[model samples]
Target: MKHIVPVKWLLARLYESDVVIVDCRFQLGKPESGREAYEESHIPGAVYLDLEKDLSAPVGEHGGRHPLPDAAELTVKLGKVGISNDTRVVAYDDQGGAMASRLWWLLKYLGHENVFVMDGGFTAWKNAGCPVSAEQKVLIPARFVATVQHNLLVEVDEVRESLGTGRYVLVDSREAPRYRGEAEPIDRVAGHIPGARNLFWAEGRQADGTWKSAEEQRERFADAGLSQDDEIVVYCGSGVTATPNVLALGEAGFTRVKLYAGSWSDWISWQDNPIAVGDEEARNDG
Candidate 1:
């Protein structure tokens, strides 16, 4: 709950000048649908940020499918949307917090700590019968300064070096089928990085599409037997879905959580990286 706010909380601050609401609804392979949906209706005073265009950079050979946006460019985009350093940003999406959490993680990586993901997303808002508008507000651009947090990210080489070393716990946030190499619809190669544990990001949320409580998130991660002091690096197909798990880990009181920004896609780009099929087994050797 530290990084997520409920619908009622956002509704109360709907008109606050300092609180900026962002609509981050995105669907894979149907990128335009999100904007089209926003054009139809969205929370009043909300601006839309597209996942593939605004949130991610152009794909490269080795940087994964959705690379992290350039900080300077993203800062300009943020400023254009009236997000300054002190602005309290609330990001929402209908994808069960996955898309919204991406914006939240990006803001935190940019050294803006006041951002949060809206719990239950757009569905919860509409179900509550809150005010919706089709009007888009054009506001004066504000100044956004970016102070990048380098330690919050890990490179492919770093992940490779730490394999089987217990230096960090690499968490695969994809679904069980993807992790087990049973199905791979998006990426070129199947399976996950060797030594990585599967922790499907969706588990961070409840069956009702709402996020779990802090204690519940802790219990969800408890199966991993992780300690608060352990170094945790989370990743998914690209680097998007893993964000929810990163935020969830933080909510679970893990102090040293980080993201492997390139994720599985980037890891497989080299072709020389080791890949493991089937479930990663627990090691009994000391």
Candidate 2:
């Protein structure tokens, strides 16, 4: 029922008729490797969803590298994968929960509240000696109705408009180097959006790969000077990695948070948008 479930929790419900486990393991560099790994060996009875093909829309001039897929199309895919309105979903990945959290965020945005991300991902399952199989699963399709929750997402225009207004707290979820414009392996622009503070998504997890406790998450955000009531807007390079931070904000007791689904890539797509390099300025101003 929680947003992040442990391997033991999933192992207990592995065979439940109402539960579906999703394999969201993806590599940004090798886009096909996640499917290859799923084909090679995955959690028993788990289904695979490609980040590029299934989770996101085709990239155009505007919607960033990984745009949100159409709601109708996404729910249709969910139906084919045996996810009905009431069916519970548990998503997992090897990439430290980024890919899995993307699915978790999508399901939530589609108004599916029963979805959850598996903590520590497939590696934790393997380390725990859980069963793994190479056989692919095919389940009876069911209707999945989507009620889109538009509040969970913030477009580039909204992000731009909120700058220097203090209406929303912009949190850049990229690594410190990328946030500081020191290194950029992806995206043409190196700097981050003006008036954005950096909070690397990886900090939400512990050294052992498990997510930190609620209290720990609170401490993490509090150290970043974020309060529970702040209207936080999170973003990453192409909107994939920011989901973890969004999830982390929820765990930290923040009820109001939104994801900048276009992220930096989309932000930079508009040449007129302002970008800030180095560290954040003393004030949150565009």
**How high is the lDDT of residue 247 in model 2?**
92
What lDDT tens digits, residue by residue, belong to model 2 across residues 240-271?
99999999888877989999998999999998
Candidate 1 C-alpha RMSD relative to the actual structure: 1.4
lDDT against the true structure, per candidate, is 0.93, 0.92
TM-score of 1: 0.98
Whole-model lDDT for model 2 versus the true structure?
0.92
Model 2: lowest-lDDT 10 consecutive positions = 277-286
TM-score for every candidate vs. truth?
0.98, 0.97
Model 1, span 148-220: residue lDDT tens? 9999999999999898899998899999999989999999999999888899999999888999999999988
Residue 215, candidate 2: alpha-carbon lDDT: 87
